[model samples]
Target: MALFLLAFGVWSWLLWPTFLRNILGDEQSWSNGSPTAFLWVHVVIAVVSLVLGTVIGVLGWRAHRANRRS
Candidate 1:
């Protein structure tokens, strides 16, 4: 969806570099330690967006079906 694409673009611009650097540096490797800030940021964004998008999609689908039946 348009919203998802916009969100992804913004997220990539803000966090993609940090994520790549963290992984390449091995900062998140289990042997080195727990995950880094980059992973956490991505996780939070992903979870929140997924949940919100699901809700919105369901609502929109229901509305569309209702309109068609009327």
Candidate 2:
């Protein structure tokens, strides 16, 4: 589980920036010089996911270390 969480967190870190870049460049992401709902929603989701992933990864790492010590 800890390893899974760590992998997930790393995946999120690697994925979100590229996804955000794609979203920013996508035509559907903009409308009349403003960002569309699609862009906003995706950005929010990505940000939240990144934060959660980092937290979960840290917890997982701590758990892994604790287990090693026990």
Candidate 3:
């Protein structure tokens, strides 16, 4: 579920703006706005961090469970 949310969030950041642009033309609209370079970099970081955090959390949880069982 977390992975799915992460993927969705990433895809939304990447494609949603362009999709809105297509519907509303080049000019800014209520739905679709052009993304700045800074925004793109931020989005990438957000996606990466989400995935990395999830992996780290899972590993920690597994280790904790193993220690309990032992």
Candidate 4:
């Protein structure tokens, strides 16, 4: 599960810029909206993934500790 979340986070991190461009509009061609606005959405996704990854790591650590204690 941690590995999956880590993979997802990495995937999103890799794609975030591309996704932002798609949302805002292509840089090399005609663009219609504020790139900054779409950038915030990208920021949100990044922040959420960071938070989720941290949570997953913490949970995994706790589980490991519990297992070791028993």
- lDDT agreement with native, every candidate: 0.58, 0.89, 0.54, 0.58
**Per-model TM-score versus the true fold:** 0.54, 0.89, 0.54, 0.50
Model 3 scores a TM of 0.54
| Model 2, position 31: C-alpha lDDT score | 96
Candidate 2 structure quality by residue, lDDT tens digits, 1-70: 8788788888888998899899999999999999999999999998998999899888888888888899
lDDT of 3 at 61: 58
State the lDDT of candidate 1 residue by residue for 1-70, as single tens digits. Answer: 5445445555545654565455556655334567667666666765565666556656655666666789
Please list the residue runs of candidate 4 whose C-alpha ends up more than 4 Å from where it truly belongs after superposition: 1-35
Candidate 4, clashing residue pairs?
none
Q: Residues 1-70, candidate 4, lDDT per residue (tens digit)?
A: 5455546555655765566557445453333543454456566875676667566656666666666789
Pitting candidate 1 against candidate 2, the one with the higher lDDT is: 2
Q: Given candidate 2, what's the lDDT at residue 54?
A: 92
Models, CA RMSD each = 6.8, 1.0, 8.5, 5.1
Find the 10 residues in a row with the least total lDDT in model 3.
23-32
- In model 4, how large is the Cα lDDT of residue 30? 32
Off by over 4 Å in 2: none
Please write out the lDDT profile of model 3 over residues 1-70, one tens digit for every residue.
4445445555555664565445344333332456555555555665665566566556655666666789
Look at candidate 1 and give me any clashing residue pairs. none
